[model samples]
Every structure is written in structure tokens, then in C-alpha cells.
Target chain A: MPAEPPVLEPQFATAEQQRSASVLGMWVFLATEVLLFGGIITAFLATRVFYPHEFERAAGRLNVLIGGINTVVLLASGLGMALAVHAAQKGQRWATLTWLGLTALLGLGFLGLKGYEYFADWRDGLVPRTDGFDPGDVTPGRLTLFMLFYFVLTGLHAVHLSVGLGLVSWLAVRVMRGELPRAGATVAEVVGLYWHFVDVVWIILLPVLYLSGHHEAADLHF
Target chain B: MTERTVSPVATVLTFAALVVLSLTTVGLSFLRMGPAGHLAVGLSIGALKAGLVALVFMHLVRSPGRTWLAAGLGLAWLSILVVLTLSDYLTRHVLPS
Candidate 1:
């Protein structure tokens, strides 16, 4: 059976035109997202410049092993998403759904690891602005500032990942109903863009948040 | 939009590179790099990984000029924010008291 062409919206003269518009809109939205996270990152960097030792010490307390594993997990998920988009473009519905399912699972795995890491942080008394908060050897004030940045950055990232997970799962449902790879390829492509962007954010976060300090402890436990 | 397809080979290669780069960043942290050294190395590796993701995984290379413009504009604005903010913060102690 021949693939059905996407329904052209009344405002757009051609299907091609409408698809481009949708993609462009998504990219523009992603650009604004860049600035939103970028602003917080800038503030973190400036604060680090002021008290490098405190920040590094604080970062050292973070669980690098978890962060490192999540980086690879997210990267693998990105591969799944890229493959899903490729399959969708070829009009392979089953392939698209399979890849999408795997992608969402990997995303869930990332969040799971992140949640475990957070729990470990709580056990370690690293959560800032709490009665049980422990600054260790670092100054309490600067360490609290660093912890605030950590929680804010990672918390926002988890929120974005959760959103991406919802989008991917929705695409999977559409693919199952045969609504995708025929008329919904653009939608898949757009969600793929969002998923990869989230992975990119995590990639950037890994180094900034987890790897900027000396790791004297060689144990990967917790 | 043109339906450009990335080969699975290329996609896998990008993923491998990203994983390798991630490990490299972590490994570098074990060294006794001073604060600036650690930040520079970590962020440099990070910037490289981000570039790969943007160009390959994000499909920026195959995207049209308008899309490129949007990505570029985002980077430009981010640069302005970082440069301006750091200038003041990094230079406050430059003048002899």
C-alpha cells in the first residue's frame, strides 16, 4: 500500500511547507530552552570562579559513578531515538515503535539511576537548606550555594527528561495505532529533536556538575 | 523539510564517541588539575561532546538555513550572557587596592 500523504493544514500551501514550519517552530522553542538553562549555568560558573575550592569540594562530594553511568544511558537512548526517527522516515511502523519503546525504557533507566543518586545524597546529608545538611570540610555558606545549584540544575534536567519520556510514549501509542510513519512522521521527528536536546543537556551537565573536582575516593560504591 | 536519513552506522559511531568522551571527562577529573585546569578540561571535553550531539544527533547538519539560524542565535545569546557576566565577576580583583 502506498503511504498516505500528510494532511496539509489550511494555513500552509503544501505539506512540505507545513512540515518545515512545524520543525522550525520546535527548533525556535529549543533555542529559548537553551537560554533558560544557559542563564542558570552562567550563574553557576560565576559562583565557582569566586570560590573555586568550595565549589570543587562540593562537586567532589557528588556521586560521579552514577553521573557517568547516566551519561552513557542517555547517550544510548539518544541513539535509539535517532534510529526511531530514521525508521519513521522510512515508513517502518514496527521498527519505529520498537525503537521508541527501547528509547523510553532507557530514559526510565536514567531517571531511576538519578533517583537512586538523590537518595544516596540524602543519606550523605548533601541536600542543602535542610537541618541534616552537612558541609563537610567546606565552608557552610559556599557549600550551600553549590548544593543549591546542583539540586536546581539536576532537578530541572529531570523535569525535562520526564517531559521527553511522555512525548516518546505518546509517539509510541500513535505508532501502534498506525497513525505514525504515514502522516505523523513529522511529529516523531520533532519529538526526536526534543529527546536529543535533553541528552545534550545531560552531557553538558555531567562534566560541569560531576567531574569538575578531584576524586580522591576510588570506590564506585553509592 | 527534506526526509534525510542518517545511516545506523553513523548513529552508532556518534554514540560510541559520546561515551568515550564522557569517560575521558571523568578520568581527567582524577588528575590533580588545579581548579582552572579541571574546569577548562572538563568543559572543553563537554563542549566537544555537545558539538557532536548538536551536529549529528540533533540533525543540525541536515537542517535548513533557518534552523541553523535559530541554533546560532541561541548560542550567540548564551555567549553574550556568559561573557558579560564573567567579565565583571572575574575582573573585580584586578585593580591594585
Candidate 2:
């Protein structure tokens, strides 16, 4: 007798059903992710409202150049990720794979650059001034608090980026195996949605954390 | 991924242009902007870039009207969350000056 064919598990009844479910599930998941970051933003806003001077003084010590570049990198990655989904949904397999690969490559590039920037921060003595750091940029005491927020927000975003890359890698494997179907491209679509949401978070974060204040510096670092 | 709304080349090129836009936006941040001005412009550019990406790349433009509605609802609710929480922060009294 012939061997059994692989059992294809039907997550939903039809392509339309899958698409609808995927979109709905992604939207709900995004709601939760929004609240997660929402809490962080709320805390930041509260701190800023109460201690505008202190926050500004602290923000000034951050590397605006790195933050700005990161914003562009993430935004571009979002675009690429969206395009990947677009290509996939339309059954343009080659374009889909190309865009997907580009997206993943860009994601990895961002992580690499982020690592380098983080190292630079440590070298600059930005590891919480309360931990006996003195970067000679701001009041050591307040600077410590500022770095604390900086690490918290961007660090979390970085963690999200890693998770996103992992997701993309898994999706890529499916694509390679032809398991990621063109007709039912819900998984790719939803993953792209998650990716775009993360990018939006970074867009808001860069300005708030890096460029929130401006007092003319004697020497522009970037 | 709706090909009907846009072409492959169009999507890729638009993304390229947006990449350029993002670079310019970041570059502008180095110019002197008071705190609020800096955030306002930078975030505006970010929002625009995001919108373009969504419209062209995410098939939001070509998606059925109802899908767009679902998306709008999602974002609206998200904005509500931000605004409501922010109201408290903005209106709070008795904090260090």
C-alpha cells in the first residue's frame, strides 16, 4: 500500500475565514501589545510633566545621532516587511521571498547596530550614573535617572526586535518549504502587522527619548 | 498584498522613497528644534512614513472597505488609550516643579 499523505490541518474553514481570523487575532494581540507599551509611555509622560527640567537635562546626555539613525532603520524595515506580505498575498512568490529576505537582513542589521550603539553607551559611562558613572554630560544624579528610562524603553524595543526577527525566520522557513501558502497568506500578513506595530512604537520612542530637548551644545557630537 | 491596488515596482519604489524620507527626517532632527518642535516634526514624519507603508505595502489601500474599518477601529482605540492616560498626566497637580 502507498504511504499516507501529510495531514493538512485546517485552522479555519476557508481562505476567507483564515484571513478574517488572522486579522482579528492580530488586532486583538496588538491591543495587548499597545497597552504594554502604553503603560511605559504613560509613566514617561508623567515623569516629564512633573520633572520637565530634569528630564530634558537627562535627555540631552543621550546620543541623538544613534537614536535618529535607528529610527530610519526601523522605519525602512517596516516598509520592507509590509512589502513582503504584499508580495506574498498577491502570489508573487519571488518578490515575496526577496522582500522577506531583505526585511530579515535589515532586522539583523538593526540589531547589530543596536549592539554597537549599546556598547558605545557603556563605554561612555552611560550605565546609570548612580552606578558611579560620570559621562561629564549632565548632573550625574539626574543623568542616572534619565539613562534608566532610556534603557527601559529602547531596551524593551530591542527585545521586541529580536522576537520579531525570530518570527520572521520561522516564517522564512515556511516560505522555503512552500508551507506558507499564497492564497492563505494570513500568517505572513499578521506577522507583518506585528512588525509594523513595533516600528510605530520605535517612531514614537526615538523623538521622545532622543530628541525631546535641545540646548545648543558647545560641540555637536554627531 | 493586493496587487490590484498597486504594482510591484510601485510598492518597491515607494518604499525606497520612504526610506529616503526617513533619512531626511532624521537628519533634520540635528537642526535646532526646541523640545516640542523636535518631537512634533520627527513624529509627524514617522507617522507619514508609517501611513505610506501601510497604504501601499500592507494592502490597506486595496483591502476591502470593511477591513479598513477594522484597522481604523484598532488605531482609534489605541489612540483613545493614549489620550485618556495622557489626560491624567497633563492635568495632574502637586508634582515637583
Candidate 3:
């Protein structure tokens, strides 16, 4: 007697139907995520319109070098994730594991760099609402507002990145255990899409966070 | 597992372009553009890089209509919110005339 083939659910008559539905579901979820981040950004932009100079000055005080490096790191992680998706589709288990592992490592590298920058900012008195927060030629209140936006935006992004790291790590383990490929490529594809969307958010955040006030670094440390 | 679809070489190239664009945005920021102009340039570059990543790395370019519709609807909703909110805020007088 031959082993039984994997059973498809009644709702999804074909494997392709199941895969399309899964992908569509993930996209819908990501769309919601866009609005979640979008609301914060909209608030920031409104604040910017009112306090352009203060915002720019406060922006300059951030560590652009570290931020820039983190951008590269995240982009690298995206590349690894894209490759992992390709490998998963090809049914190369070991290759999928390798790429996913690399993606997670890069994600960790991003978080590490981001953590270091945050610590440096805190020590430098850059945190809004904290004492000794001084940005030259800009009112403390305005500067504080800018810092508030900065922290909130980047903090939210960090949270998302941490989640991506966990997801990628989980995917790697599953691939190692020979679980995912058997389940079909939908899981890998949707996971890849989520990872890339995170990367896109950072790509937008990089400029809004780092570049907006970078030109006028009146008192930058680095 | 299934057959490979996206080309690895193309993905790598897209990554390279994104990195280069990032560096360029940083470098451009060092020059004096007014606040609005600076933001415009930086964001435009960022958007371009994002387009590459989305279309290539995310496989949106080859995705089915269902996926595209989902993604488009999200972006459209976001745009509506941003534009309308900004319009109202930008037009209001924050100070006494």
C-alpha cells in the first residue's frame, strides 16, 4: 500500500488556491500595518510643518553614521530574506536554512546597532522630556517635540524589527526541521513579503529620521 | 518546495542599488537645501529605493491581481489619510492674525 498524499482542505480545492489565499491574507495584514505606522508619520509631518527649523536642528543631533550603517544592515537582511524565499521555493532545505539564518543575523546586527545608538543618545541627553536636554538655538520645547517624534518613530520601527527577527528565526528552525517545504511555498513567500515590508518602512524612516536635519549639524558629536 | 521564480542576480543587483541610493541620500543631505527641498529630495530617493525593493525583492511585480489589490488598497488608504490630514493642518492658522 502506497503512502497517502497530503490532503487539501475542502475550501481550498487546489494547492494554488490555498497559496493565493495565504498570500492575499498576508498582504491585507501588511496593509493594516501601513496605516498603523502611517498615523504616526502623519503626526510627525504635521509637527514638522509647524517647527521646521527646530525639527531640522534636532534631527542633526542624531547619530547619522550609526543610522546609516543600520540602514545598510537592514537592506542586507532583506537580500538574505529574498534569497531564502527563492531557496524555499526551490525546495532546497539547507539553502533555505542558510539564507534565513543570515537574514536573522543581519536583523540582529541592526538591532544591536540601533541599541547602541539609543544608549548613546540617552547618555548624551537627547531623550525628550529628560533633564539636561539641550539643542542649540532651538527652544527646548520645540526640540523636545522633535525628539518625541524621533523616539516614537524609531522606537516603533525597532519593535517591528524585533518581531521580524523572531519570525525569521522561527522560519529557520522550521526549515531545518524539514517542516516548511512540505507545507508549500506560501509560508515562505508571505514571510518574505512581511520582511520586505519591514525593510520598506525603514527605508522611509531612514530619511525622515536621519536625513531631514542632517545638513545643519551645529553641534553633532559624529 | 516549488520551482524558483525570481532571479537571485536581479535581487542582488536591486540590493546594491538600494545601498547606493541610501549613501547618496545621506551625502545629499550634507548640502544646504531648504527644509522642504531637502525633504523632497531625500524622500523621493527613498521612495525610488522602496519601489525597487517592493517590485523586485518582494515579488510584487509578478504577483497575482489579488495580492496587488491588497497592497494597493493599503497604500491608497494611507495616502488618503496623510493627504487630507496634512491639508487641514497646513491650511489652518496656528497663530492669531
TM-score of each: 0.95, 0.81, 0.93
Return whichever of 1 and 3 wins on TM-score: 1
Worst 10 residues of 3 chain A by lDDT: A1-10
What is model 1's DockQ versus the real complex?
Answer: 0.79
Q: Candidate 3, which CAPRI tier? A: medium
Tens-place lDDT per residue, model 1, A1-115, is 3456678889999877887888889989999999999999999999998889988888887898888889999999999999999888788888998899999999999999999
lDDT of 2 by residue, B1-97 (tens): 3433456687768768777876776566567766667767776876787677667766677767766766677677768877887787777664645
Clashing pairs in 3: none
Q: What's the number of clashes in each of the models? A: 0, 1, 0
Model 1 chain A worst lDDT run, 10 consecutive residues: A129-138
Report the lDDT tens digits of candidate 3 across residue range A1-222: 122243577898887777777788988999999999899989999889889998888777788888888899999999999999998877788888889889999999998988888899888888886364765666888888888888888888889888888877777766666655545355788888889999999999888878887554453354
lDDT of 1 at B15: 93
The 10-residue segment with the lowest total lDDT in model 1 chain B: B1-10
lDDT per residue (tens digit) for residues A1-222 in model 2:
122233334865565665666676775677677778877876776667766766666666677666666666776787678778766666556677788888888888888878887887887777776764643554567667777888898889989988998888878776666644443356688888788778877867776777676634442454
RMSD of each: 1.7, 4.3, 2.9
